[model samples]
Target: MIFESSHCPEDSRVETQFCQNLVAQANVDRAITPERSTSISPDSIRPKPSQAIQQIILFTPSRASNPQIQAALVKLQNQVAAELRSRGFTVQSVPTGLDSASAIAWINRRATPNTFALSLQTDAFLNPDARGTAAFFRAGDPQRQQQAEELVKRILRNVPTLVDRGARPDTETAFGRLPFVRQLSVPAIVLSVGFSTSPQDRNILLTRSSAIAQGIANGLAPRPVQARSTTQVPIRIRLNGELSENQGFILGGNAYLPIALLNGLAINFQRPKTAQLFT
Candidate 1:
């Protein structure tokens, strides 16, 4: 169930150092920047089924809470709350002090039988470079409930390992980088954010979104794939603009694949572009 980016760099000090540099640059860039609200515009996107959607916004406080950070937290919480409400989500916040048991108990109290839960680990600090944030959903019809469970398992399994191994604030990032150990019993999607320099990190975000889009479309519209439908095809795609030199697995349709077939597909894969393949 481990969904790893095929292109994630091997663990090395030099590679880590390069990643650290990128992290510093990104932070500096964001530091002087104004806060802008971003969401899937209603005109461009449709809503998911409310009955099928259960959401939990659990907040965990960091172990070290500075005044500046606390102020920023207030701002982010307000922004995130407003954004979720606009998307028709009923948001709930839990401020748990670095206590895993208390956090779990709070979430258990708040979680519903058929709802999507967004648990924010308050203990972890947000870093742009080593972290990623994203949302995930099912891709195809008959998307077994187990698929949702497995996705969480695959997606969250790596978080704690990295943190335990000293995941730096700036250098190691991805939404799925933090380890969360709650057993999800229903079909649910998680919107995760974290820092990462590797394409594997970004690609995971892209694929997770694609899955959510596909799932919503199928679940709301109920268009089943044919039994004999081709779920996967080996394609050679030619990268042009931004996707030309992306070093990672390519995701197409509902699959995450290696980059071998980039030249086979007719996608405009170029530098600064991403060429995702179907596995």
Candidate 2:
């Protein structure tokens, strides 16, 4: 998210400390999980776990005209790749200085159905006031749209100061089509972190680099979703004809509202001592 400021701010000690804390937390969350019991019965056999789909291909625009912007993009790309590697992702970064066609070809040669690709670039405009975070996906593709939304959402969560330009189709881009989003065999997204022309945005890109990288890493490789029961399916909830942010679930042909939602509505309910409610 990008916001306007009067001057380009220097990286303060406070910002450095904050970034360190965020990166540390991200590492802990991604690296640690609960351990299963080690003791096993003699007759029991352990099944081999399926291989994880954690491959990622990351790259940045090789032809950025501005030398300063190009250098910053490379730095941000390396920061994101390092963060993802710390989170146990197998990240392959396309070499810098490759032209667009060659970069796309390199990714295509390595991409598979299980691979996810992300191209990072800072936006620029004649109008310096135009500054914000935006992501582009293949036009009319739901999966790409979902991935783009998640990417923007994660970034905003990490840095709320920037305006959310929202997820857009590649057709809406100035170029009308981004090969990185359209030509790759795997799911792909093109992220515009912020407008390099805007001083405020440049300050953010400089000071909040780690947070931005962590946000990108989080979006690209989100935590694994827990298995759901077959009897349960997600359902949207509505209140007074307005959609509620909190979702409920349909279980055994019945719609169940979450306790948190009921509490928000000021509804009073008593729980039995033996009852367990999961939100």
Candidate 3:
């Protein structure tokens, strides 16, 4: 999120405090979960336990000393820290120089598994003083890396264009062209709060990470894969009833399977509902 201010000094302070609070939340969430145990019969085999999902939060701010931005940034950061700590996340907030290359380099230093970094401008989106700003994620199966990429791509396609005298100009100057780089492995979705000028209203832009999560759960999107030869295969589908030359077969892709008949020979191959590109 990019925040615009009249003076740089007025906004630098908010950014610094925001970074500090995120660091504190990261430390608190790292504490170990309490253990509990129950014994099974000696003859019974032990069951494998499910592991917790780990996520890291990274924040990048261009100017760190501005007073107006710093106050807002720090208060917002502290609120974020408290919320994330209540949930389970290791949040690391880092304040760095405005140079895009250097800020990215600073982020690289704190990289971890399932890390999500948020780079925002000072005072980008000012939420109402009462509501406070927040991005909510619906907890479910962890979203895969490929699904995240596709959603992110769709989001980039949707970014509002900035126009200058009928000519489009770059809106994000500090992080010029950084969003397109795809080297980072873990999927990241950015939630930004900023001002919108169509009707001169305050708006929140949700990058749809949760919607991506749902699409992935339903297996509507394909996972990322390496390049491979486009080999075609002949598919021979079988139906239960006998076929006659005079009887024309109508194929319908949308059908719900009966759960009770699944255990029988009525249904065999498990296939996704989406249309297949290859036949």
Candidate 4:
């Protein structure tokens, strides 16, 4: 005989209750089980795994009127793009000679949350002595300011000979706002590698192009975030098996000991001067 409900016969209360419990358990099990499809289809529109991270858009000024400066900027731009790609970044090399508006439009079209844009260009000045590496970010943006600072730092570290012009706001530029730095939704910067007008700086850019590219790659490379523990682990110090008054602390898996605790260790060391510490 067919029952009205899918449960056990209602005539037997015990059997009905047991069936009800079973039904409830089965419903819960079905709810918790993850849904899976037997058939799978590939999505052509999905981006490859490698394209999802560390995407960089590299470009040079299309309005570089000076033939010499334009050539140098393009050469440097290509080198930087190659270097970044070698480091596993997805590099989009925007073609040279696109007008400012066109270039910005092209970049914004492809820019994602993970994308970073850099405009590589050479500075020009009538003084001819204006030479050095400078980076500009939008004014009042601390994040971009830090990024600019790091970029300059890495470039200087790679090529010590190049003078550090330091990171500045776009407001300091001849034109108040840099479209490349301000227009993009993603973080962007204008890197003036060196003054093409300066004889010394021009020579360095031409000769030390590889080192500069490596430096730019290094600066753009993502740094691993170090996890810091809120709980401080105290390390006990012992002098010849006797507990000493001074104690050390464990941080980032390393034990840091006080200088005073090293007195009886028979190790000779000089205290670092104030200037040395800062350096």
Q: Which candidate has the highest lDDT of all?
A: 2
Q: Give the candidate number with the greatest TM-score.
A: 2
Q: Kindly list the per-residue Cα lDDT of model 4 for residues 35-89, writing each as its tens digit.
A: 3111111211222122234799998875334666577667778888888888788
- The sequence of per-residue lDDT tens digits that candidate 3 reaches over residues 1-279 is 432121111234675356445435433433342111111223321212213335544453543443444444444444554445445567666654445555555555666654655443323322322111212111121343333344334333333231111111111212211231222333333333222212121222233223323322222122346665444332333347732222222233333333333544466666668744221
Q: Name the runs in model 2 displaced over 4 angstroms.
A: 1-53, 224-279
Give the CA lDDT, 0 to 100, for residue 146 in model 4: 91
Ranking by lDDT: 2, 4, 1, 3
List, residue by residue over 179-272, the lDDT tens digit for candidate 2. Answer: 7766666777889899887888888988888899889888877766766555768899879999999998876566777888889989888888
The TM-score that candidate 2 achieves is 0.61
Q: Per-model C-alpha lDDT, please?
A: 0.38, 0.71, 0.34, 0.70
Superposition error at 19 for model 2 (Å): 37
TM-score, one value per model: 0.32, 0.61, 0.33, 0.60
Off by over 4 Å in 3: 1-53, 64-66, 96-99, 122-176, 179-185, 196-279
Give the clash total for candidate 2. 3
In candidate 2, where is summed lDDT lowest over 10 consecutive residues?
A: 1-10
lDDT of 2 at 181: 64
Residue 164, candidate 4: how far off, in angstroms? 1.0
- Candidate RMSDs in order: 20.9, 20.5, 19.5, 27.0
